[model samples]
Target: MLANSSIDNAASQAKTMFGEELIWLFIFGDLCTFTLFFFIFGHARTNNSVLYHASQAKLNVHFGSINTLLLLSSSWFVVRAASAARKGLIQKCTRALAGAFILGAGFAVFKIIEYIDKANAGISFSTNDFFLFYYLLTGLHFIHLLTGLSLIAYFIYNFRANGITRQNHATFESGAIFWHMVDLLWIVIFPLLYLLP
Candidate 1:
């Protein structure tokens, strides 16, 4: 009886820390997808080292670095927002979330400009295997950023109107978790796509 009770308590604690089962399922699915893509990219690079390196050289490192900083700053604001929500500081939380959203928007703008420049240079996904991965991976991450921005907007509206309190803090935390995942994905992508040559 004691062992069973202990096991049950551990499971309860895990669920509480991880959030809703559906969210965990979504996150795990995304992780698996990205992991597979990364593995394929690595294998391809290994098989075609010269082509991969030559293609990687054509990428704009400066733009990639700026976007990295933007996402990192946005993630910081999200952390602050979550902390403010926990303390019942609705105004502070709203401001932090807004900052995060703006930084995320800045990332999107920079990415669009980069894409435009690449297009002008006659680069397309079909140009090479490296370009194919570049476009597919970064484009997927961009979609994730847009989705996160929408979620942040909803949270901001909720904070302004209903206010985040201890009772509703779980919702804020869950959103933050999703935003952090977006940031984490970019961090992995930036190094692999830009700096790994």
Candidate 2:
């Protein structure tokens, strides 16, 4: 019995290590893709300085700022939720996760509004290279935000249905990690697309 138990533990450890390595591989690949896109975007802007500045001028800082704030705040909620779950506070963790999910949805709604207003004002993805990158990066970021939110919502639903147990910690941690990645990506995106001159 002891030998069998030891073998099972070793197998579990190996699986855990493999899973972590896979996650890191994904994260690195994502980072590399974004980096290459940013490099291309930077080169285009450098060559077409006038058009880039003009495009930047048309962006609504107010809307971008609000979305930034929402995402930042949501990141905090996700972090707290993950911490609470780790400490075995199920109710508090659930509320925090729910709050983060709602805030992410709010940001998505505001982005849609901003996009509509920009389109009404004759701005679009085809406007220029700068505007194209702006739309693409933010659109990609929004997709990540929504994906993270969906994961959190699913975890919450599953937890509620099954009752929170120690096993839920891994789900909570994964959701928090995903949320932080989205927030961190936006931190890079906001300055490049909105504030940088």
Candidate 3:
């Protein structure tokens, strides 16, 4: 009976580790999709196809740069929020969450402005390959940004109504992690989409 119990414990521990490993594997797989997209895009560029650069001139770099700053700053807010949640400081956590949510909204607004300006210039997703990928990646990222905002809002509502608990901390931490991924994705994207010649 003792031996069977020990075997079961070992099996359970191994299974838990395997589950965590699988989660990381899935995350890396998504990263690879972005990586492959950038790689192929780089290879497809033509000497005459300074079309991307020309198209970029139609973009509002000032607005794009501001959105980048907003996301980067929001990342700091979420990191503080995560720390506050772990320490069980409900007020601090709520304040940080609010700040992050505001920054996320600012990013969305700037992105909308960018879309409108580009459209007015007759540049759009259907305009060319550069615009297509820009729309696809940024649009997908916009969805993730909204999802992250929703998660933060839920955290604030739950924490206000009921105070912080282990599950609340976990949810906030997970949201921070997801939000950071969105920010980091934009770091890669901005350089590729805007800066590279």
* Tens digits of lDDT, candidate 3, 80-130: 987776556779988999999999999999999888877887877998888
Counting clashing residue pairs in each candidate, in order, gives: 0, 0, 0
Model 2 — which ten-residue stretch has the worst lDDT?
1-10
- Give lDDT: candidate 2, residue 186: 88
Give residue 132's lDDT in candidate 3 (0 to 100): 88
**Candidate 2 lDDT:** 0.78
Best by TM-score: 1
Report the lDDT tens digits of candidate 2 across residue range 1-197.
11344345434644565223455666678788888988998899899999899989988888889999999999999878766655556688779888998999989999999899988999889988888898899989888888887898987887667655534444445556667878888888988888886
Candidate 1 ranges beyond 4 A from true positions: 1-15, 165-168
Write the candidate numbers in order of decreasing lDDT: 1, 2, 3
TM-score of each: 0.89, 0.87, 0.84
Q: Highest lDDT: which candidate?
A: 1
Candidate 3: the clashing residue pairs are none
In order, what lDDT does every prediction score?
0.84, 0.78, 0.77
